[model samples]
Target chain A: MRELIAIEYAKLKKFHALKIIFAVYMLTVPGWMYFMNFFFQMEPGMKALFTSDNPFDFPHIWSYITYSASFFNVLLAVIIVVVTTNDFQYKTMRQNIIDGMSKQKVILSKFILVFFLSTIATLYTGLVGLVIGLIESTSYDWYQNIHLIVLYFIQTLGYFSFAFLFAIIVKRPAIAIVSFILYFPVETIIGKIMNADAYQVFPLKVFADLTPIPFFKSIVVSMKDQGGKTPWILDTNIQIILSLIYVLLFFLLSYYLLKKKDL
Target chain B: MQQEIVLEVKNLVKNFKKVQAVKSINLNLHKGEVLGLLGPNGSGKTTTLAMLLGILHPTSGSFSWFNNGTKDENRKRIGSLLETPNFYPYLNAYDNLKVVGIIKNVANLQERIDSVLELVDLKERGKRPFRTYSLGMKQRLAVASALLSDPEVLVLDEPTNGLDPQGIAEMRQLIIDIAKEGKTIILASHILAEVQVICSHIVILREGEMVYNGSMNSLLNQEQAFRLSATNMEQLEQALHAISGISITERTETDLLVTCSEKIDGSSINKRLVEQGIYLSELHAYQKNLETIFLEKLTQ
Candidate 1:
């Protein structure tokens, strides 16, 4: 397992696509945070902008940072798809297998790399959020906020894992990215057209549910005015459990296909 | 026989939908021997190699390596280059080798990587991305990767497929050196001359079946020997028919070739022709080259 991890790390380092995605993340996250902090001040009337008890508080800074960095997470998911699928596209998987590594180990390495990268992004977001929040206001509840920030990191991982599974199953970066793009809007339109409460149980809905804010309430006024009356399909615990199931199921399916594949 | 054999495939079979790529093929390689696997396109050479390396599963039958262990564990003692070298295009040779080293679980990986690069004569270009490499360079790197682990067995499929004449010669020498170092090699190629020059034994496959397998010398020895040329072609033919132990197998404008069942010197044939009053122009011993033998087998 250790050797497999080392191999995957070397592969991730050698892959330009991963490096470019990471570079973009590093540059854009800090740049966007600083831009928001120094250049664009939030107007007093903007309710969406958290002012008092802002989730983007110090020591809990990652919470706000991750919220703002979600876009980049989506991009990272696409990159993961590309990295995994290229092995198939270029027929390198056959070479790798012949070189001595097992199919299980190869798929595990990809999962490990994705998990590690998502963790880093989540922590980076959290830390930046805390620092920027402290700079904004020092009197915030740094201790309680730090706890929430940790929860946010976990939630981010859960969501990222779900996206990673999609990438794995689809095995094409472009298709995965397009599917990710259409995910939320399609879920929204379908949920409205069907007016089915059960639609909220979808994977995307589970992801939205894990966020600090509720999904339906944020989108529709009727759902919001109901004031928690809408069905709470899954709390954080259920979301985490389902996300893990998604990871296991997709990883197993991917492994089976890879093992049996003709290359 | 068991002690000398390095690899054995028994009744191995593989199919792709309606096409049978390998049909009940069996092969064996001995230590310090280069076995040339000769076949045309889609003749199952590559497929056989793939199955040997555990990249492609056989539809039936079984193959074992070293005769004692599982395929994956035994694979550690074997190295193969079945097709084009595939690497992270963005990475330099050194980094690409580093990744392979890690996956292969080699000790002293850096030193191993350096040594392999040197062995393939790609040390100077080791730091360049694979995308920048020429075709021959890529092949050398592939060879280097196969050599990295210093396995006892090396399997290569068309190792010099796209190389220039000079590159092919260099590769041929390299393969020879590897074989001399006591490594068992299975080299698959369509170039009969290359195989004839480097391989001690040969296996010829046609339409997913083994058409021939034996030593190079034995395969050549099986061909008939006797060439006849005469000034009077009609008299030469009549005299050749009257002679015992000599049977005409081929006829051309300039010569009539016969296969002699027993060893007979050119002088004896000349005496017999002279006694028959048939003037002989040329009489020489016939020896079949690898190309001729291969063409004969293919046609057969």
Candidate 2:
């Protein structure tokens, strides 16, 4: 497994597009966060939700980072698609098998790569959050916000693994990215048409709900002012569990398809 | 001495949707033998190699490598090149081989890569990315990768598919050198002359069936053909028709080709034709080479 990962790492080192996507993600996440913070500070009306407190403070800082990082999952997912589809496009997957790696090893290599990418994204998010929190938080509290890091990791894993599955099912990178983009709208439309809470557990919805946009607090503040009830779904535990299950399902299906499909 | 069997394939078949690409191929490769898989396009040669390498699943039948049924176990001892040269297009030739070395688990990585690069004559261009390479360079890099592990068996499919004449000669020489090292080689090619030059044992596939499989010497040792033509083509035909031991296989405006029993000689045919009052314009005996045999089998 280490050797496989080493080989995968070597392949990625020369893969310029993946490097570009990763660099953009790493740069964009923090840059976007700073810009959003500046905008919120400029607008007094938007600033009333947290009562003039630094949103980058410990407890609230987790939400700030997680919410911003969640959107970049699409970028990370595109990275996954690019790396996975490259092997198929270049016929390197078949060559790997011919060179003596097992089919399981080939697929596992990609899975490991996705996990590695997600882990890196998580660490980068937490590091950025730590820097922002240290500069802004009046009360230093690290342990209180660590669970957000865990949730962020799971969310990234869920998205990247889903991308891996999409690459396997749809071998072309362009089609896979397009399909991945359309997944949410398509699933949401279908879920609303079905109009059953049961169908809310579908893949895209579960991942979206995992580390949700942290605007529920702001919505609740305005709703309280207007005497409206919170329509937010607050079950993080259920979302985490379901997201993990989807991650496992995506991985197993990718493995099955890679092993069963002709290279 | 009995050679150890390195590979044994029995009743191997592959079907793609409605087309049966490879239908029930069976053959054996012994240690240190250069085995050639010969066939034209769509004859299932590539499919057979793919199935044996575990790239394509067999619809039915089974194959064993080094007497081991487990693919992983057997595959670790084999190095294969299937179809086109497949490496990361953006990676240089040296890095591409490094990837293969890691997968195949070769020791002394730098030295092995260098040796293979030298062998394929791509040492100077090893730093160039695969996408920048010409077709021959790509093929040379593939050969370098295949030899990276110094594996016990080498399975190559059309290793010379897109090379110029000189590149083909170099690639053929490389295979011959590897074979001389006593590695078991299974080569698939549509070039009959190339196979004749490099292979000791041959399996000929026609329309997914193994029409011929045996020693190269045995397949090439066909009955010698005698060509004869006379002033009177009609008399020549009548005289050859009256002959019991000989059968005329081909006849054109100029000559009649006859295959006779071992007891007959070219002089006897000539003497008989003379006695029958048919003056001969030409007469010669010739043995069939691999090309003639291949053409015969393909037509059959």
Alpha carbon lDDT of each predicted model: 0.74, 0.85
Q: What are the clashing pairs of model 1? A: A61-A129, A61-A130, A62-A125, A62-A126
What candidate 1 gets wrong by more than 4 Å, as runs, is A30-43, A48-66, A145-176, A179-197, A212-231, B68-70, B238-253, B259-279
What is the C-alpha lDDT profile of model 2 across B144-183, one tens digit per residue?
8888889999999989978999988888888888888999
iRMS values for every prediction: 1.4, 1.1
Q: Score chain A of each prediction against the true chain A by TM-score and list the results.
A: 0.78, 0.91
- Model 1 C-alpha lDDT per residue in residues A166-198, reported as the tens digit of each score: 665666767876886777688888876875666
Model 1 misses residue B75 by how many Å? 2.5
lDDT of 1 at B299: 84
What alpha-carbon RMSD in Å does predicted model 1 have with respect to the real structure?
3.5
Candidate 1 lands at a TM-score of 0.88
Candidate number with greatest DockQ: 2
Residue B125, model 1: Cα distance from true site in angstroms? 2.3
Q: lDDT for model 2, on a 0 to 1 scale?
A: 0.85
Q: Reference contacts recovered by each candidate, as fractions?
A: 0.65, 0.78
